[model samples]
Target: MRSYGNKLFLFYIILTGSVLAVLGFVLGQLFPFYIVNYFSENNIDLDTDQIDYIKKQFAFIITFLLVVSFILICLINGKLIRNLLDPIENITQTARELTKGNYRSRAFAVGPANIVELRNSVNLLARNLQEIEKIREIENERLKTLIENMGSALIMIDREATVSIVNRQFLDGFQLDLDEVKDKNFLTLGLPKRIEEFIDHVFLTELPYRKQIEIEVNQEIQYKQIYGAPVVGEHGRWLGVVIVMHDISELIRLEQIRKDFVANVSHELRTPITSIKGFSETLLDGAFKDEKMLISFLDIIHQESNRLQMLIEDLLELSRLEQHGFSVKIMPTSLQEVLIRAVELTSPRLDEKNMQFNVDIARDVTVAGDFNRLIQIFTNLITNAITYSPENTTITLRIKKNDEYGIVEVEDEGMGIDKSEIARVFERFYRVDKARSRNSGGTGLGLAIVKHIIEAHYGKIQVNSTVGKGTCMIVYIPLRKKRN
Candidate 1:
C-alpha cells in the first residue's frame, strides 16, 4: 500500500524542485548582468575557458546542495507523516476489533491534538456500544428466565407463521421437541385445531384475542385460558403473533366442586327436614290422642331432631376446619395419651359389639399438634372402624415413632373400600355406602374432618384396603422433642 510518508515525500520533492528552478533563473539573469558591468568598469577581461570553469563549479555546488536538501526533506517528511497516520491506524485497528466482537479493545492516545480527539471519540462510541450490548444481554436472559418459569406455555411465530420460539413450559406441557416444530409453518405443526384457529385470527386481525379452550390430551380433558396477541414491528407493521397458554384445569374443577357441594348440602338437609316436619305433623293431627301412638310419634320426632343436630354440628366443624384462617393449637402432645382418649370415647360401641381390641403402642412418643384435634383424628377413625367391622371382629390400634414422625394406624376387618372409590373417601359428605352410612348414624363428614385435622398438623393419612379384606388407615404427624 502507498503510505502517507511516501506521498508527502513526493509532494515535498516536487515543490522544492520548482522553487530551485525559479531561484536559478533569477540568479542567472541578475548575476550575469551585474558581473559584466563590473568587469567593464574595472577594465578586466576573462577568457571563455575561465568563465566556463567558474560556471561548472557553480552548477556542481548547487546540484550537490539540492541532492542533500532532498535527502533531508525525505527524512523529515517520513517522521511527520508517521506522526499523523499512527493514531488513525490505531483507531482503525480498534474498529476492526469491535467488529470482531472484542468490545474491550481500545486505541492508545497518541499523535496530534486533532488525532487524539478523534481517538477519544472513537473510544467513547465503543464504550457506549458495549454498554448497550450488556443491557441487551441482561434483558435477553431475564426474558428467557421469565418465560421458562412462568408456569404457562407460550409460543412465538414469525411473519410467515412459522414457529420460531417455544419456551420450556410449552415444550414440556405439550410434549414437543424444538427440532420437530421450529422453522415449520404453524398449520403443519400438528397443533390443536382450536389453537390453529386462534393463531390465524390473531394474525389476520393484528389484535389481541383471549378465550377459554378445552382440549383432550392423553384422553383427559384439559382446560386452558389462551391469550393471543399480534407481535408488531416498527411503524405498526404486522410481525406474526405470540400465544400465551395457561392451564386452568384446577380452577374449573374447583368451581364444579363448589356447585356440587351446594347441591349435596341441599339434598341432605331436605331429607332430615322432611322427616322432622312429617313426624311433628302426625303428632299434632290427633296421633297424640292415643297414648301408644303419641309416644311412638314423639320418639320419632326426637330421633330426627338428634340426627339433624348431629348433621348441623358436623357441617359447622368442617367449615371451621376448612377456613383459611384455621390455625391449630400446636404444642408437644403425647401420641399415647391421644390414642387412649380416643379409645375411651369409642369403648361403649366396642363393648356392645364384643369386638376384640389389639393395641400395640409405644409410650411417651410425642408429636406437635393440637391436643383436642389429635384426639378427634383417632376418634373418627376408630368409630368408623367400629361401625364397619362385624361383631366379635378384631380391631387393631398401633402407635410408634420414628426420627421424623409419630405414626398411628387403625385397621378393621370390615368390608374394604372399592379401589376406585378410595380417592374420593375424604371428600366432604362423600359416602361409599350411602344407605348403610346413614343407618349407622354417619354424617359422611367424619373422614373429611379427620383429613383436615391431620393436614393442619402437617401430617399425612393413607388408606390401604381390598374388596373382601379389611381397610387400614395410617396417619403420620411430625414428631417433636419431649417437653422438659
Candidate 2:
C-alpha cells in the first residue's frame, strides 16, 4: 500500500504539507486561548454565571478561528500543489505526443531536480529517435536505388493482394502499366493460376515459396522464376508478401545451347572419321585383295581425310579468334575485295547447287577490318545462303556505303527462320530447321565463328526474315575505325 499510494511523491508532499498546516492552526488557536485564560485569572474577579458565559464564548470563537485557519491552510496547500504539478502536466502532454510518433516532442524544465532528470531523459530519448529517423530516411533512399539497379523484379502486395510497392525493374521487366496495376487484384487483373496458388500457399502456410512458371503473356512465351517471402510486422503478424521475379529464359537457352553444341561437335567430327576408320579396317582385312576395288576404297578414305582436316582447321581458326591478343587489323579496305573473295571461296558450292549468284557492289564501298576475318564473315553468310536456299532461288550480295560505314547484305530465297529462332541464330548449334540442318551437314559453328569475327572488327549483324519471303542478313562495318 505504501509503495502504491503513500510513497507516491506528489501525494506524499501534499499530504505532509496538509498535516503540518493543520497542526500549526491547532497550536495557534490553543496558545491564544490559554493566554487569555491566564490574564482573566490574574486581572478580574467574576461571578460563576459570568465566568461560565465567558468560557463558552471563548470556546466558540476559538472553534470558528480554527475553521477559518484550516480553510486558509488548504488554499495555500493547493497553490503549492499547483507549483509542483504544472511541470508534470507539460511532460505528460509531450509524452503523449511522443507515443503518437512525434519523437521530436520535448518537456519543460520547471519541475524539481528528480523531475528535471526525467525531462532530460525524455529529451535524450527524443534525440535518439530523431537520429534513428534520419538514418532510416537515408537507408530508404539507398535501398530504393539498389532495388532499381537490381536485375530481378521485386513487388510487394498487401494481404488483399493490392500492389503497394514495385521496384523500377519490376515495372520495366514486364513493361507494366503502373496506373493499371496500382490497386487491382491479381484475380481481376488476370494472373496465372500457378502464381495465385503460390500466393495462397504462402498466406495459408505463413512460409516462403519459389517456383518457375512458363508464362505466355501477350502472345510472348517466357520462363519466369518467382520467389516469394513473407513480410512480417510487429508480433509476427503477416502484413504482406514480397515477390521477386527473374527472367531465366536467356540462362535456360544458354544451357540448352551448351548441351547441343557438345552433341553436335561430337557428331560433326565423328561421322567422317568413323567412315574413314570403317573403310580402312575393311581394306586391311580383305578388300585390298581385290586391287581394282581397293583403289576406290582408298580414294574414299582420302576424301574423308580431307573433310576431317577441314573441320579441324575451322575449329582451330575459331579458337584463335577467341584467344587473347588475337585482335583484328583495323584499316580501311575495299569491301569489294572481301566480298569477291568470299564469293570465290563459295564458287564450288554455287556450282554444286547449280544456283546463280547476283552481285551488286556500290562503287567505293569500303570497310575497316582485318581482311581475312572480314572475308570469313562474308563467306559464312554467302555459304549459308547457298546451303539453305531452294534449288532455283538466286542468292544475292549487295554492298552500299554511307558516310560512316559500309553495309554488306546477303539475301537468300530460302525457308526463312522462325521468329522465335532468329534471336539464337548466332548461338552455336542452334538450328531453325533441325532436320534440314543435320541432313545438309551444317556444322553449326559457321555463324558462331562469323559473329566473333564481325564483333572483333567492331561490326554489327542483323537478320530480317519472313516465313515465305527469304532472309536478308545485314553486316555493318565502319568505313574507318572511329578513334576514341
Per residue, candidate 1 scores C-alpha lDDT tens digits across 246-305 of: 999889877876887788788888888898899888878877889998888888778878
Whole-model lDDT values for every prediction: 0.85, 0.80
TM-score of each: 0.66, 0.66
Q: List the residue pairs that clash in candidate 1.
A: none
State the lDDT at 286 in candidate 1: 79
Stretches of candidate 2 exceeding 4 Å from the true structure? 1-134, 187-193, 216-222, 289-292, 324-326, 359-368, 400-406, 432-441, 478-484
**Which pairs clash in the backbone of model 2?**
none
> After superposition, which runs of candidate 1 have C-alpha atoms over 4 Å from their true positions?
1-90, 141-208, 215-222, 235-240, 247-254, 286-296, 322-324, 347-365, 385-425, 460-476, 481-484
After the best TM-score superposition of candidate 1, give how far the Cα of residue 306 lies from its true spot, in angstroms: 1.6
Q: Cα deviation of 361 in candidate 2 (Å)?
A: 5.3
